[model samples]
Target: MRRRDVDTAVRHAALTFGAAIALMPLLWMVSASFMAPGEASTLPLRALPRRPTLEHYATLFTRLDLARHFLNSVVVTLAATLGSLLVTSLAGYGFAKLRFRGRDAMFRALALALVVPGQVGMLPLFLLLRELGLVNSYLGAMLPFFGSVYAIFLIRQYALSVPDDLLDAARIDGAGELRIFATIVLPLIKPILVTLAAYTFMAAWNDFLWPLIILSDSAKYTLPVALASLVGEHVQDTELMMAGAVVTVLPALGVFLAIQRHYVRGIMAGSVKG
Candidate 1:
């Protein structure tokens, strides 16, 4: 019993250390955001603000017009999450349930496409968007993500465990495929959908490279792109940058926290079902 207790204590200690190491930067970012303008760069490397102030945040909102970028981020993220859910869920259902010639081969091709780097296609995608007159628009920034191979794969894998008999019964009762999917498959896969939404939201929130390339107008810049621009000019404003970081990170964190219980349950249930 003593030996077992010692082993458990060691494991807990190691896990605690790992958790602290991972979270330390985020904790410090929040702490530094509240510090006075020059206080964050002080000699002693303080973790807590000697005096907290929201001046930087005020500067961000009023002076820098960060709210525009914040609104842009929220709109884009929410749109992407909803759009991804609609597309990935339907595509996943088609893959998991629908029978058709070359279905397995088509899925294999999609899986193969994943090995190709996204950047390889960006040049052509940009040209295509330009032709569509979507350049520098929200649609341009969002176009690439309307379908995601990984998201489809995740949903398809989870959806495969749903009983096909339920679907067949609905079909035998003269129900359309859409009705069966909406009534039966969707409820059984709610947890995974929540998980997918969280992931899609976070990705859309943090995406920088594609948005930077597609959106040239400053007014349309997402939060991450706006933050990057801020850093270029405010290199010396450590506290201000940290404040921007806090604003950029908080929404994604909030989203994950809101869905964390569902995410956990989904993975657990999926594992058992699979």
Candidate 2:
């Protein structure tokens, strides 16, 4: 083979190998979820189940009432994603386009918050939520996501790339600020918003800490917390645990896959705009 062709072949082989390695655990988890109880822990590790069954998944939905927990996760994740997108996008646009006293200073202070560990503020946040009677509520669970500095920063950076002349033209044509934002700015920044939605969805879906801390009611428990309880109660049920793992991972994976093209484009565009 020619040298360039040989190099291309080697690169593709390496990427394929890396992809397989990365996907192995997920593939195995799906495989094991279909295996009967105790089959996953057999003497010889099997890549595929000898006899695939949905009994574990059935148990998760029926006896364990994981359906409730699954619903809780869905509600919390969707609310958090939508709320975060709206708040962050508006704040970002304001920061990028609107002029006000101490605007730069305020943004700098907000940006400084990104350096602080999220764990550091959970105590005070919980206290505030308690005062507001929001503890153990879905709204409380979602409130924290609406104020993300990183999301605001990303949206602001992307919004900065909006043409000043376009905005000026809109103002001259008798368009109000809200009208221009809804009709012009939003369409221009759609890629970044889709990217943010995907990110917020994944983060909120997989989040265990804040929900666990804020929500005390067992009925209100998110999937991760419910899965943790399952681990404690059914440590020996490997197949069942794998089944729960699949449930926990599948939605986030699906959302990412669905929006992957927009996600990539948004990231590239945001990077260039910033």
Candidate 3:
């Protein structure tokens, strides 16, 4: 074979192998979720369930209190994502557009602070939440994300593209800063807002560590924490664990797939501007 042709064939084989390896775990998880309790672990470990059953799902809803955890995940994710978007967008726009002393230096400091690990502040954050009486509450789960340095940076980057002429016109019309931000800047940055919202939703929804730490009660467990607890208690039940994984993963996957176009666009825009 010609050298170029040989290289193309080898690359094709590599791609096919990599794709199969990546998909194998997901396939196994789905198959096991449908299997009867012990069927997933039988001698040969079948790739497909011998007999599919929804019994595990039924058990999850009826006996395992999965519904409550699902609700908690939803409420915390929505509140955090929305609240972060509003706060970050406003701050970002102000930093990008409004003139102020030490603005650039302060934003740079916040950007630098993003490099610090979240775990470094975990102990202090927990103590603060406790003092505020937010411990074990949904607000406690959502509070840490109300101010996001990365989100502010993203919004400021996007807001920099807004025309100065537009703002000047608004000011000439006697519009205040807040009014201009609400009516003009927001509509112009809708795509980035959607992108940021999707990011916050996915992050908050899949978060395991903070929720696990703050929420001591079973009633307030998010899906990931609840699934971990369930796995501990039901380790032998492979099918049940697989079902829980599916439930935990599906929402984030669905939301990503739905808004993926805008998400990709936002990333591209940020990269080019940077």
Clashes of each: 0, 0, 0
Stretches > 4 Å off in candidate 3: 266-274
User: For each candidate, what TM-score against the reference?
Assistant: 0.90, 0.92, 0.95
Candidate 1 structure lDDT: 0.88
Show the colliding residue pairs in model 1: none
Model 3: per-residue lDDT, tens digit, 1-274? 9999999999999999999999888888988999999998889879888889999999999899899999999999999999999899999999999999999999988888777878799999999999999999999999888898888988898889999999999999999999999999999988889988877887898888899989999988999899998989999999999988888877777888999987777678667744
For candidate 2, what's the RMSD? 2.0
Candidate 3, poorest ten consecutive residues by summed lDDT:
265-274
How much is the lDDT of residue 1 in candidate 3? 95
Candidate models: Cα lDDT each: 0.88, 0.91, 0.90
Positional deviation of 60 in candidate 3, in angstroms? Answer: 0.7
Every model: Cα RMSD to truth:
2.7, 2.0, 1.6
Off by over 4 Å in 2: 1-9, 265-274
Number of the top TM-score candidate: 3
* Tens-place lDDT digits, model 2, residues 25-53: 99999999999899999989998999999
Clashes by residue pair, model 3: none
